[model samples]
Target: MTDRYVQATMDVLGAARDVFSGHDTWRPLEEAIDAQLPDDYKALIDAYGPVQVNGHLYLEHPANPFYPLRTWISETIEDFRDVDWGEEDSPQFGGKAGLIPIASTDRGEYAFLAPGNDGGQSRIFSCGRDEPDLYEHRMTFAEWLYRYLAGEEMFSPGHRDFYPGPVRLESLPTAAGDRSSKWYGQERST
Candidate 1:
């Protein structure tokens, strides 16, 4: 099942190889989160590395120094705590516990995963800066990705400004001489 999701995503994005560092590189991030990340996310990173989908969605990678997943998750959680979004009932915006951000958009929208509910399954929460309400989807990361790529209205109906044409995946440049990083300059294909 996990392989199918990874294959489907790669097929849709035209990804050619497993450009990212494997499970060893992801250890620190998983430890920080205190929970194992979804298998679908691991497969996505393993296959595509750090990528921007259609120049709109940015998925954090283990080797991204500027916006590593650990930093992004911690910072976003802190930011949610600092700002008063006026929704006390909301866990993500109101500083309620058990939610972590997974992906962020160029448009200031974010996708979060909330665990410890519904028998340990994670639920996805999509929210934008301008909107007070959040869009919730009770699916795994792979299911969500499949629906998102299929243009399902339920994922993000109002914000449909994504590049509707063929999807493009651009590999971000890594630091020079960083051989330990998966995005090392020499390893990148032109």
Candidate 2:
């Protein structure tokens, strides 16, 4: 099922028609990661594939030729694995269900997911590239996206503000073969 937040955002902003940029199967990824990701996150990727939201925020796909989800997660985890976040609630990187990056902005701000206790939903955390701390948001992925679309200051400072008016989604290549294909070459500008 499509996530309500993604569906509503698409309903207002429009989506790529007749294109499936998401994964064909998720079991392998779940198994590899040793955790079951949030349904809303899976739905978001399935609904939009790899895309640049409003030309800055990037939502990467597992099969993305430029930057696959696993590589992105690994790089992020490695980069911050040793940083002492100072807060007792700070989630460490690398584990069965640790801090996983969901989205990133061109400005180097990342939206991370901290696993919830007892099989509950993961909460969203925002971290700026230059900052030493993670900002917590006690909400689901869907809720964070909803608030982000509503332009409620969800991301770290210096990232672009949510685009004014309607959301603009630019499709990205999901596979190596699509890189040179004209169908996936163009970017939609606001």
Candidate 2 per-residue lDDT, tens place, 1-190, comes to: 5456756655554544434544455566666665566888877776666777766778777766566777777787887777787888866775665877788888778888776564554578898756776788777787788677766767765443755556767777765556422222222243
Per-residue lDDT of candidate 1, residues 13-127 (tens digit): 6635465554466778877767567778777766665666656677778767745777777887787657566865756432235667778778787787766567856578887
Which pairs of residues collide in model 1?
Answer: none
Candidate lDDT scores, in order, read 0.64, 0.68
TM-score of 1: 0.77
Could you tell me which 10 consecutive residues in candidate 1 have the lowest summed lDDT? 181-190
Highest lDDT, which number?
2
Model 1, C-alpha of 25: deviation from truth (Å)? 2.5
Candidate 1: residue 51 lDDT (0-100):
67
Clashes of 1: 0
In Å, residue 133's CA in model 2 sits off its true spot by 1.4
Q: How accurate is candidate 2 locally (lDDT)?
A: 0.68
TM-score of each: 0.77, 0.77
